[model samples]
Target: MTANPARRSETSRQAILTAAFDLVGEVGYAKLSIEGIAARAGVGKQTIYRWWPSKGAVLFDAFLALMGGGPGDDAALPDTGDLAADLKTVLSATVDELNDPRFDEPMRALNTEIVHDAELAAAYAERLDLPMRELKRKRLRAAKEAGQLAADLDLDLAIDLLWGPLLNRWMQRGGPLTHEYVNALVDTALNGMRQGAPG
Candidate 1:
């Protein structure tokens, strides 16, 4: 019996992603390496190199897999026609995700590097942040179309307002990340956008 090429390829890819994910959580991004991942995955280093150009790329793919999405996929966010409810749901999940030590520590390590490395930050934005933001923006645009938001909402500013405080709380360690806190943030941002003049 011959092994299916597609199945073998997928199995190897999954192993690499899982190894990268667990290694990053345990040893963090700086200590994570292709050799370590290959050894852990029981695959040759050449296998990983053949698919992904760098460890960062593999790690990013792992992160995407962890989020239950693929590169540039944003289907994780639900659309229920209620902006406040939807925002609260998503933001609350984000709060919980950030609170997980496995996710938090690795993300912090990656973010630290991105902060210092402009090129890496640009790549990260292109690969991760921009797609996520565009999804959120799409939801906001839907809300505007439904008259749930002001007609002339400046979506970029609206997005910043929606996420800024949450990001601040996450980065500054100024407050606890709670469902209640995310709800408040959503309310405040939505109310502000409703009342404020369009930019």
Candidate 2:
């Protein structure tokens, strides 16, 4: 029986990602290093270098993996043609993610790195934020075209308005990220965007 190189490679890659994810949670991003991850993952520094350019890159990929969606999934937002329901479902999932301890601390650490390092911030936007935002924007544009939203609705501003407060509350530790709260957020955003709503 011959050993499979491809399977071995995948195993090594997953080990690296898991090590990075765990280390960021344990040591925080500022203190994490390639050498530390290599030691934890039981691989040499060359193995990590073969796959990632920097610790931030590794951490970003790991975080996305932990979020239940890798960076390459091209699926669009669920469009059952009901914008309110879709938005509520998405926001409700976000609330659950924010409330999960396994994800919350690691995400907070990565966000802190994003805040302090401009290069890392740009990479995060390029890898995750911009793609997801564009998908949501596409959905919003569809809603507008379908008459579910005002024709003049600014999709970009609408996205900010819909998600900004939730992000603030999640990141700032401001309040409980309850399912009811996310539902309210979706209703408020949609009602404001609906036709004939007061500005």
- Which candidate should be chosen as best, given TM-score against the real structure? 2
Per-residue lDDT over 16-62 for candidate 2, one digit per residue giving the tens place of the 0 to 100 score: 99999998878877789999999999999999999898898898889
Stretches > 4 Å off in candidate 1: 71-76, 116-123, 195-199
lDDT of 1: 0.83
Score candidate 2 by lDDT: 0.87
In model 1, the Cα lDDT at residue 190 comes to 88
Error of 2 at 55 (Å): 2.2
Tell how far residue 14 is off in model 2, in angstroms: 1.6
Per-residue lDDT of 26 in model 2? 82
**What number of backbone clashes does candidate 2 have, counting pairs of residues 3 or more apart or in separate chains?**
0
TM-score for every candidate vs. truth? 0.84, 0.88
Point out where model 2 deviates above 4 Å.
Answer: 1-7, 67-74
Which residue pairs in candidate 2 collide? none
Mind sharing the TM-score for model 2?
Answer: 0.88
Local distance difference test scores for all models: 0.83, 0.87
